[model samples]
Target: MYFTSALVSRSLIKNAGIIFSKQPVPKNLYATRLFGTSLQKQAEAFIPKQRIKSLLPTNNSFRQAVTRFCSKAAEPAKGQKAVGWWLVGCSGMVFVAVVLGGVTRLTESGLSMSHWKLLGEKPPTTKEDWIREFEYYKQFPEFKLKNAEMTLEEFKFIFWMEYGHRMWGRCIGAFYAIPAAYFWSRGYFNKSMKIKVGIFGTLIGLQGLMGWYMVKSGLEDRFQDPNDVPRVSQYRLAAHLSFALGLYILFLMSAFDHLMPTKQHAIEITQKALKLRKYAHISKGMIFLTAISGAFVAGLDAGLVYNSFPMFADRWIPSDLWAISPAIKNVTENPTTVQFNHRILGTSTLALISGMWMLSRKCKLPPRAHTAATAVVIMGWMQVVLGISTLLTYVPTHLAASHQSGSLILLSMAVWLTHELKYLKKLPK
Candidate 1:
């Protein structure tokens, strides 16, 4: 029912070879009574008639059974293409969800609602509901320190940002599970592929739990003073971002497998080109690590701590890179160290991306891979520029958010490049 094209093609070729070969016939057929005739008629029937007899199988019954088996094996199924495309669409939606998550972080709306109410009901819409929700937030440290005087309108601003992000996550869950169930029920997915999707789905569910876990860190009195601003642990933030990216990469790879499976184009490309694609996945892994470091930078508000660029406060490494009294305090608790590490990771990402682009220039890569690499290079440069501007401008909210969004774009491009390289060429121009 789910035969691969290669399998069908092989079966057809084998059957065709068998059909083209001549089969032996019994000599006794010529001795039948109908064959008795004049000399010319006897000779005419003897030669070509014997050849026709040689072509037929000794037993037509056995030949018929073999033919039926070969025919069934070679016939194509109608649903294969539909199943592949459905997986691609589902992955693309998950990628969109990742982007929205970045927006939520950029706007500082990740921890807006201090409570994690799973299945509490959809967000409140009525006037009375809004007031009750706003009242709950007022009890948090963020409201006291940063938004002490924030108006109802301002509260709505942050509320919508977080709500939209949460809603998108819910939509992704339904989109993935419902279609997956439908496809699985139809027996469209292969055994190995189904296992992969299951693991991916599990990670997605875990990511939701991680989100709530991350938020819970900042909801309580982590700070001694009531006036202090509470923030999620940088470690948890890094874990959240890293897991999201992991899901993105997995979905991206699965989508690539559907769009242009390696088995489909396995022989088209040269060995060198194929090897380059393998290396690209390694590049993606490095970028993912850099992105997590970036989260650690953001969670500690590292971007705001040091305004200078190319150097931290006109120094290569600040005097007190680990100045915090406790040893572990500097990595996540200290803003300066976090910003320093972020700058280092940002620089490293730019360098590695540049290296990838340069390597691509000398190789014979597909259009999708080429385009993705170029886009990553371009966006990496833009993000660097934006990062410098953000630092020099003291991390203005708008510019900082744009820089954050730019990172998402760059990450998407990197993920796309790895996928395309693994799959093969895009459509011919």
Candidate 2:
């Protein structure tokens, strides 16, 4: 019932190194194959040679196709391409989810959604449902202490903002998990890669849990304003934002690891990468701190505090930077201090990345590595400009969203530069 080298010409199966690309499978098990007699029979001399040739494994056409298919599947390099694209999808989803989260914050819509559920559900569909949802929101501190004047129609706007964010997060999970399982089943991953996917999936689940935790902070009576305005805790907000940014970096790093893996050092390249590594790492830390500072500014509505650029209230050092007690509390717990720190951190990151780029120009480096270093400089500058614009413009929703997206872009460029520089062995000249 199967073709064998014993019966067929040996030259066909053994042709070059391409034909029998993988270990031989039982002849009948090949998914892509010409149908043959379910049961083999003795050769019949009376059978027409032309007709018999069609069923023979030695047929040139059959061998060519099987050669191509098996050649691709058996080669590990080709499989890596498939897995790389799958990771690109995951990374793309993470970027979108981060942007959506920023928009939700800009809209002041995070506290509108009072419940979190595993199953996907639609918003209130009827009068009774709308009223019930609105009443449920009324019971929360956000409505009682701050938004008591919010009409049902106004509530709908913020409701959709938060709802869209949650829905996008759900889509990200679907995009990642479905393709991950498919790629894994197709044997695209090695053992180490499988472990990485597991860890990534686990972190995604934790991000969801953190989302709920952040929302819960604003729903309680802990933090309040003199005007009785209710908002999420800055600490929790910073934690949520930090985790999201970190997750984005993970997706990016893993994607690049598979897609554009570091080529082996050809002819013992320059030592510039060694020095670049130190700068790249410091740049990454600056990006992370800047993002955290942005989170604190958002939490305290501190962007509204100083609408002027290059200075807060026209003062380099605002008088109220430590208005809160215990001194240390003013850094994270005070609006004026938080805004000041964000400005310093953002400006410092811009200066640090610019220095890294300048250092890159003085050494021989891979073209891609140089390009990535350049991107860090350009994006870092863009982030600062956007931050200043977001502040001067009073944190308009669209501008603020752009500012947040800019942070992630800067972060990605920094990570790429860092990864590229890590491969260099010696110090730059």
Candidate 3:
């Protein structure tokens, strides 16, 4: 009976040991073991030394493992950063395009080409080629009526200006398309981003078409007066400018999304932030509207008439604002009305932005948001100054171009402010 009891006791002890050995150790315990703690020493008696050594990696190996894990985790963030910067570059190209377009218009170079090609034509390089281009220009109404005294050298200046603008636009397409395809193939963009990229591409194509359409309006023999200058349709000009602004906004906003994604903790927005957001939304809309109005101002060359600010022709409102028939026609068609309306809109936008900035100070905004708000106010005032200077100087090409660029800059700031204040979830009442 004593021998049988000894065999059963030994078997029970063996089974208990196997069960304890099969249990997994926590990572903290492994770390503790590595440090040679008392608890680890105590554990060594039960866990086989050979098994412990096999399970615990060397210090260098452990560090390498951790580094690999972290790098894997950061891969997505790195991809997003690349996409963000690419978008920033594209937006910059669009900015240059806008400035170049403004210069082309200011120089009266838009009508110099007189011919349109989708893929573009080779520029005149030789003297004979230059004459051929010049002869072609002479056939257009712009040359016959407006630039009849233009020399070949002068024609070259305008031709090169228009040519540069068109070529730059084509360059934008190539710059966007090649990078976009590579990124898309790399699976960097998700489904929604893919759709936005598609839309952006389509808009670029449409903008090119719209540009040609606007140019065509000028080429047609639709002058009502023999004294009328050959210029593109004001309506077409406004449309073209609007499309460019729209694309700029989209590109900039998308870039912000990639660069400044909202944190999960930012979902619970504060009441003051919510209120400020409303103000920001209004300011953004006003900025856009003011920009659109400036396009009309450019379209009508209205800045030339409004040389005086805070008053037009020494009066608060010009007398012939509604000189054109139907009154509504005067809003866009009449230079006096367009300039007056742009002045009102511009002043109102500035006032609205200034108020929003004041409110932002009390809102306890995020750091980035606070900075964006400050930028918006500063840019708002700067834009106003530029506009006034452009007018006071009688719309010199450089000043006028700067004024146009300033509008987009102001709008960009407004966009930045709004984006910083963007909320992922609904605001609590």
What lDDT does each candidate get?
0.70, 0.77, 0.82
- lDDT (10s digit) by residue, model 3, range 289-356: 88888888887888889698778868897889889899899999899899988888989989988988
- What tens digits encode model 2's per-residue C-alpha lDDT throughout 1-429? 123433343234333213223443333323333333321121122223344454446655544444343332233444787777777777777888878887888778999988889866578999899889999999988887778899999998999889988888888888889988987888788888889999889888888889889999888876456476688888988888877777788888887888788864453455555667788899899898889888998888888997897777768888898888899999998888898899989888888898889988987787888999999999988888998888898999889989988888888888888777656665334
Model 1 scores worst on lDDT over the 10 consecutive residues at: 34-43
Against the hidden reference, what TM-scores do the models get? Answer: 0.75, 0.80, 0.82
Which prediction has the highest TM-score against the true structure?
3
Model 1 agreement with the true structure over 193-254: per-residue lDDT tens digits: 78987997898889888988888888767665856767787788889887777787677666
lDDT of 3 at 189: 89
Q: Is candidate 1 or candidate 2 better by lDDT?
A: 2
Q: Is candidate 2 or candidate 3 better by TM-score?
A: 3
Residue pairs with backbone overlap in model 2 = none
Best-to-worst order by lDDT is 3, 2, 1
Worst 10 residues of 3 by lDDT: 31-40
Q: Give the lDDT of residue 110 in candidate 2.
A: 93
Model 1: residues with Cα > 4 Å off, grouped in runs: 1-81, 263-279, 365-372, 420-429
